[model samples]
Target: MTPVDTVDLWVIPLDRPGDETRTAPHLDCRESARADGLAPPRRGRFVVARGATREILSGYTGVEPKGLVWRVGQWGKPYVELRQDTAPVPAFNLSHCGAVAVLAVLRNGRREVGADIERVVGGRAERLVERFFHPDEARYVRGFAPAGREAEATRLWTRKEAYAKASGHRLLDVLHMPVLAPRPGRRPGRGDGTDTGAVRRLRDVPFDDGWAVSVAVMGSADFDVAPRLWPEGP
Candidate 1:
């Protein structure tokens, strides 16, 4: 609550029990919000986001999940009041793609984080990259065009989007980062590595699959990604 767990990721399989519900995973997040001494979220979307959040926080606190009051910013970001008198603690971000939702937790009062997931469909990856991304990024994928051009494009797109989301920059801002250079690569731990992964700048923004996974962290110190699945309550 005061400090924060180191940057790490916990990806949950939606197929598992207590891993598929909308709010089940986040119950743990709310517990942390409360354990940290924050007021529970009263209601609205904040409640849903809060619930999803609780599930991720559960990993750290290992506490029973509970519903708490939550608040939202103008841009639809969620925040839990850690205390009645003090301002909310560290900021958080959330993104969902099909069956997957990625949550980013920050410790240093971050204001926003946006993540987008796009499933790659056939050759659409190449076309999209040409249309939306910078010339350099396009070139990076083209280099791999002979072997498997589509996959190349998808990886660049996700990394680019993740970087954009972290920057809180608009879809247009992705251009600021070089698209031609094949995105910064992060050699997956050999065996368990993603087919696509790379780090951009010092923020550690990386993603795989031109399916277009992107995240922008709005001015924060720490970041972690947690995959949430609905939890079953009996």
Candidate 2:
């Protein structure tokens, strides 16, 4: 068995006042706010997520958050820019919904990561699974008892989205990719048995308060996912 590289994840709550201040100095919150054009509530969440991303990455890179450079891929994935003289660039992804944000970072030599989080909402999980999930995934979700369908659907959605992000492929392009079914008494495997060297592992992040997070990494089967709650700053 190969040694699994560990992935570091940070779950930050955006509802607190000081959340913005903690990472505000490291990101252009005002510009992001303007570009968002969303109503106040949504805009506020965006600011917190963006700010927290910078702060978290800064801690890992030892660079001022505001000094970090980023570029967006053709598929709209954001990545840190690396200078020729800088150390190896880390792989990271961020997702936010409702009042929480999730950030996943992988610094191993095979750095590639994607993560997503979604708040559980009633009455939409089945519909979403029907419309967006692969045929097998949809069937698997439907196979769950009616009372358990929503949570299972949410898990599948997050897993699929995370894999898509990690692969840098459009969500539609990867919908057909199969996902491993959750074992009766065990955790789901990282890969959904479709490992072609791009996405070889998956880890479901554990959180409280009805939110689900999933992370996908591009590497060998020996990789571990570690989740941490970001502390509230003064």
Candidate 3:
């Protein structure tokens, strides 16, 4: 089990060779059917992302990846079904964009946790801010210079997405929600040493340039994020 105050954030690169072949065998029927229905690269990516998720969770649960069953919530969140398992299962959420997939696993007695990653695209930032962002969040993005606007926008976008996923709320419903307020004694954009120390607060997860990552969890206690790359499979 993960430490009570820690959330494991796994950053996975989905383009590795034989990713599909290696992970495919571990996917259950529904996932395989879903992959079969998708076209070219999307099918391949889906296979890798879902398969990798199962593999990672398996390491924690002592269950084979194929033995894991998933159930979806009314709000469209997917959760593992622990129908027959006696071991504790970690709460987790997954998001993938471009060639990278991110998973956030929480074993701290919190069931609501989410993670997201997005490629930074400057041209669409202003328009999205104007349309969906809260007034404060919009201003936060606008406060950045043109050169920095996209990264700021992407950061805020990921945070909002992570929160929405964690809360089981529709993205459209929470798009206007504010996420700009910083927790006491914490600085924005610094995930390494900053702790939200409470629920409903967003944490910015540092990632490679050109990509933005964020994780959100529910609870009224302090928690820290430990980011690590997904280890290469044998």
Candidate 4:
């Protein structure tokens, strides 16, 4: 069997009290949160998410979470910035929804990573597809039985968002782009389309209780993903 690159995914619960204490020392993170002008609860979520991200990255780099520097791309993607002599940096991305946050870490710093978690709620799935999905994707969603349409739409939406995040593109930029269905058991190097050289894969995060989470990684190397809930404690 071909060796696959691996990524570590950490899922964190925002409701925990310890998250605050763990992340509070990162004053820069707090400044960013305060700048958002979000309400208290929303700001709290931001603090936890930002803290979790730093804590996770620090675990791998041995750098204090607050000491790590970041650079944002023109399109709003954020990545760690490392000095030339610094040890290999890891690529990471963060996403949160409802009461949870997901952080994806790619050891190969050259690769790009993106993640998104969405709460599943009742809505007019068909109408949403028409508004947000690519023309072909919308038709594909509609083809599903009405009963399954919403689930299918949610899955595809995650896929689309994941891809956009990995590519460092905004969701709006790729909403209309064609997304190929995932192929099972395919070799890692196989190209699905014109962009085959970049490894792109999406996996369902087994989130119970009405949540959908997906992570996307893009690079030349094939990767395996290991997902785990954040361990208790700071």
Query: Quick one: best TM-score, which candidate?
Result: 3
Candidate 3, position 158, lDDT: 86
RMSD of each: 10.0, 2.7, 4.6, 3.3
Of the pair 3 and 4, which is ahead by lDDT? 3
User: What is candidate 1's lDDT per residue for 41-70, written digit by digit as tens?
Assistant: 223233454455665554434433353345
* Model 1: worst 10 consecutive residues (lDDT sum): 187-196
Per-residue lDDT of 95-213 in model 2, one digit per residue for the tens? 88888888898875366788989877775867888887677778877788887778878877787789888878888877777665556434556454244655457777777756678
By descending TM-score, how would the candidates be arranged?
A: 3, 2, 4, 1
Instruction: Please provide, for model 3 over 1-234, each residue's C-alpha lDDT reduced to its tens digit, 9 standing for 90 to 100.
Output: 544467899987788888889899999888899999999788999999999899998887878889988989888999887655586778899999978899999874345888889998756766798778778777777777889888878777888788878877778776866676474224343121122343464687778888888888766444689886786444
What pairs collide in candidate 3? none
- The per-model lDDT (C-alpha) reads 0.49, 0.75, 0.78, 0.71
Q: List ranges where model 3 is wrong by over 4 Å.
A: 1-4, 183-199, 232-234
Give the Å shift of residue 95 in candidate 4.
0.6
Q: Give the TM-score comparing model 1 with the true structure, all chains together.
A: 0.56
Give the per-residue lDDT digits (tens) of candidate 4, residues 1-234: 866767788898887877666676764854575836877677778878887787788787878878878788988888877654566789888888867888888886767877777776665555677897778878877787877677767766776677788888778776765554534222223233225344566666567756667777775555677887775454
Stretches of candidate 1 exceeding 4 Å from the true structure: 1-5, 15-50, 58-69, 84-88, 110-118, 173-176, 179-234
Clash count for each candidate, listed in order shown? 41, 4, 0, 2
Best by lDDT: 3
Error of 2 at 85 (Å): 1.8
